[model samples]
Structures are given as C-alpha cells and as structure tokens.
Target: MMLPWALDVARERDIPLAVFWIQPATVLATYYHYFHGYGELIASHAADPAYEVTLPGLSRPLRIRDFPSFLVDTTGGEVGKVVNAVFCELFEFMDEQRRNVKVLVNTFDELEPAALAAMREHLDVFAVGPVVGSSAEARIHLFNHAGADKTRYMEWLGAQPERSVVYVSFGSIWTYSKQQMEEIADGLRRCGRPYLLVVRKDGRQEDVSRCLEDVVQERKGMVVEWCDQPEVLSHPSVGCFVTHCGWNSTLEAMALGVAVVAAPSMFDQPTNAMLIEEEWAAGVRGERNGEGIFSGPELARCVELVMGDGARAVEVRKKVESRKGMARDAMAPGGPAERNLRSFVMEVQSSDEARRKDTNTISPPP
Candidate 1:
C-alpha cells in the first residue's frame, strides 16, 4: 500500500529502491498484466465469473473469480473504483521506473520459478525468501500480543502426539461469519482430529466462541485468540494446516513441511491456493458451495484428503517435504536467497556509482 509513495520518494531523491513484494510473484505478475496488457481482457469478462484467462506465468487458465477481486469488481462501486485506481497507479509507478527497478520478492526461487523468471523480463527480480527467521533466536514478532503468554499453547502443542493435530488459522484480517464459523467447527469435528484454531479476538470472537463452546469444553479442540504461528507450524504434533492461503502462512507451512488444506478467501489467497494445489502439489484447495462458502463437508473432505492415508495424501506430503528442504536451503547462509540479496546490494551500489560518474562528467550549461 505504501509502494507508490515509496517509489515517489526514492525517485525524487535519486535513491535506488527495491520493492519488497509481500505477496507471491504470481500476484505481482497479475497486477503487472492488469495494467500493462490484460485490463481490457479482464474488463470484457468481469461479469462472467466462469470465464477463464491465462496469464503468462501461470500454468492454468484462471476463472474471473480467481483474478484479484478488484479486477472483476466492475459494479461502478466506490470501493472497486478506488482499488482499481490504486493498482493502476502502482503499475504506472513501476513502469515509470522500468529501467532501474528491482523487485525483492518474499518467495523462494524454487517455489515460483516461472513467476519470478517472468517478472525478470520487465524488472530486476530477486527471489530472496522465505524471508523468515532461520531459527527461534532470529524470529521477529511484529504484532504486540498485549502481554499474552504464548507458553500455554506451546505446551499444549508439545503434549499432542506427532503429526496428530490439525492447525487451523485464517489470518488476522478476515473475520468469518457466524454461519461460516459454525461450518468450520463442524468440519473440524467431522475430521475427528485434535486441532488448534486461532480466531482473532475481534467482534466475532464471542459469537465464534458460542459456536465452538461444546468442542472447547469437551477437549475436542482448543480455540485461542492468537498464537505464534511459525512456532505452531514447526511443532511436531501439527500435521495438516487449514489456512487462508495468505503468502506468509503459505510459505511458513511449506517451510515447515506441514501439509495444507487451503481455504483461501480473498486477494492473492485463491492464487496461492491454486499454486499450492496445482503447481506445487503440496495441498488441496477447499471446494466452495454455491454460496461461495466452504461447506462443512467440503472442508472435511479436503482435510481428510490431505491428512488421510491415501495415495494423494502421501504424494502431497512427499512434495511438501521436498519443498521444505528447498525452502530451508534457500534461506540458509550462502544459499540462493542470501546470494541474491548480496548480489542485489552490489548491483544497486554499482548503479549508484555509475550514476554519480555520469553526473560528474556532465558539462554545465552556464
């Protein structure tokens, strides 16, 4: 969101700016196409939810519903208009800085090789991720928990058997409707697994608590306001993650080799979910019913598919395990992420020196 301002300030000051894209490179490419080439194509089909458009880097054709919500939201509504304007300005800003632009993506090279490569044609793209701590000592928690103790959850997780718990968290931003909350609770119960579900302490907490009161009291599941996600994903007891497919959570789950049941809700989530299910083969995307809600049975099916002793489940686990090694290797010292970061710094320094030399060589008009 601060991208446009950052670009403006950097350009005005002649400072080299590298964009740290927080979402997948695929999402970056989507936005790039939206402004550069595919805006008309998207606008033409905005009303057709099932219409499919194939982007350059993506392997499969994506339905209109799969595109970023802003693109298909052509209702002439103020929110849609504002979002469209922001993205348009964002891409225009990138275009203005085309020559000297660098994008530092929050994804490992192995994860989105094609997307990263595709972006490189337009900008200096670097895959310097999973941009997470290599160890507990290096971890940084950006959010203040308001003096909440994290040890209780950790201890509870420690008590569970290895690969026996289902970890469910839909990031902090989106709140589930009461009906959706009940559906998820029912799904978790149907899965018949010990689970840890993080429902943020928001307006919906009380309602969500009411829905899950029986489960919480019966020790079938534990619902917390918040927990250290990375720590939870890393725990041995955690087997499958039901996530919103937010990039950070996606990468963390991949890094930890925890299989996922992607219940993507919005923005880049659907894209990430597609990548997880299709490209990486690390997880399955939960099926949404006609109302665009993931029904309890559908969620249960996805969880069982990911966690059950089936061929697909085994394959997904294998793929996740392999990618886990790749993610760790990429983040290790002297690995791809570190090497690319060092190279980016050097290139920026070199560009700065050359620019200085060019300035010094210019003759005064006076």
Candidate 2:
C-alpha cells in the first residue's frame, strides 16, 4: 500500500530504493504470480473455496483457501475492496520497476529456496532473514504490557519437565469468536498436557476469561494477555506450539526446534502452515470444519501427532531440530543473510557513486 508513495518520493529525490518484503519469500512469489499470470485463474475461482490453483516453483497446488486472505476475500465491502485495489496497484508498481529493483525478503535461503529462486528469475531477490537473532534482550515487542510479571511465566515453564507443555498463541492481531475460543480451550484440555495460552486482552478479554476459567483453575494451563513469545518458545518445557502460523512465529518456533500444530487464521498464515506441515515436515496443520472453525478434536489430534510418543512425532522433532540448526547458521555472523546484505549495500553505494560521477561530468546546459 505504501509502495507507490515510497517509489514516488525516491524517484523525485533521485535516491535509491530497495523494497524490504516483511512476509516470507513464498508469499512474494505467490503475489508475483497472482499479478503476472495466475490472477485470472484465482479470480475465476475466488468464490470456490475448494478450487485449487497451481503456480510455478511450488511443489503442490494451493486451494483458494490457501491463497492470501485478501485475494480470496469474497466480501465486497470497503475493507476488502481497498485491500484488493492496493495489492493490484502494488503489483503493477513492482512490474513497472522489475528491471531495476531488487527486493530484500525477510526469509532465509534454507527456508524457501524454491520461492527465492523463482522470484530471482524476474528480479534480484535476496534472502536476508530469519532476521531475528537468538538474543533474549534483543527481541522487539511491539505492544506494551504494563506491570506484567514476566518471571512468573518463566518460573512456571522452568518447573515443568522438558518438552511437556503445549504453547498456544494466535499472534497479536486476530481475535477469536466465543465459540472458537471455547473450542480451542476444549482442545487444549483434551490434549491432556500442561499448556500456556496467550489470548490478547483486547475486546475479547471477557470472553477469553470466561472460556479459560476452568483450565486456569485446574492448573493445567495458564492464560495471559501477552508474553515474550521467542523466550517462551526457547524454553525447554515447551514441546509443541499450537500457532496461527504467522511467519515470525513460525520462524521462531522452527529456530527454537519446537514442533507445531498449525491453526492458521488468515493472510499468509495458511501458506506458512502448509509449508510447515507438508514442505518442512516439522509439524501438522489442523483441519477446519465447514464453518471454517478448527474443531477441538482436530486440534487435539494435531497436537498429539506432533507432541506425542509416536514415530511421526519423533520424526517431526528431528526435522525441526535440523531446521533450527539451519536457521541459526543463516543468521550467524558473516552468514548468508549478512553477506547478502553487505553485497546489497556495496551495490547501492557503487551505483550512487557512478551516478554522482556522471552528474559531475555533465556540462552546464544553459
């Protein structure tokens, strides 16, 4: 949405511009295809949730439900209309500058190699992430939780056995309906494991309080409005993360070697969930019922499948551990991300120097 204004300002000021894509490289590729050749196919089947669309460089065909929520949103309301328009314009802007622009993606090479490669065919795309580091103090928390005791949760996690707890959080933005909250509460209970759930105390505080009262009273779980997610995921006692599959959360869980039970809600989350369950083989995606609600049994089954004593669970853990090592290597000093970033800086500097020399050489046109 801000791309047009940014580009205009950069061009007017004769400055260099490099787009930093905060989403995964896979999503960039998806959007690239959406605007390039697959838009019509997706638009034709926008109303059909079961319809699948195949794009280049992806191993599997994605259903309409798997596409970014903005594209698949049937709501013709103002919000949807504005979202659709902004994305269309953003892609058009990218297409116009594809020859000169390079995008820095917030993802790592080992994470989405194919997606990165696919985008590189059109533009210079660099994998400069799992941008987060492993330092607890270096973490960035956007929201301010006033007077919240952090040690209480840390102490609770410390007391639990290694890999014995299910950590549930649905990112910071999305709010759940009362029914959905109850279902998730029931699912956590059915999983028969110690759990820690983070339900933001936005508008849904009363509902969340009501739904989680029993579980909280039983001491089987704890519900807080917010916490340090990376810190929690890094804890030894957290075995499985029941997540919304947001990219940051997904990357954090993978980096910390925690297996996931993906419960995606919107946007790039469904795609991230698919990659987590199918591509990476580090987790399982939960099944949603007809009304698009993830049922309690489905959640429990996914949690157990990833966190249980079964062979699949063991295999998932091993895969996640392997990826965790890869993520660490990618973010380490002088690693791929750092090297690519350095190269980009050098390229921009060289370009700017050449431009300055050209300007100096030009004679007065009076």
The TM-score values for the models, in the order shown, are 0.93, 0.95
lDDT for each candidate structure: 0.84, 0.84
Best by TM-score: 2
State the weakest 10-residue window (summed lDDT) of model 2.
Answer: 93-102
Off by over 4 Å in 2: 1-3
Q: What is the C-alpha lDDT profile of model 1 across 202-314, one tens digit per residue?
A: 73667767886766876976788778888889899998999988989999999989999998766788788888998899999997777778888888899889889999999
The C-alpha RMSD of each candidate to the native structure, in angstroms, is 1.9, 1.7
Clashing pairs in 2: none
Error of 1 at 227 (Å): 0.8
lDDT by residue (89-157, candidate 2, tens digit) is 766766776644668998899888888888888877878888765775776676778756789999999
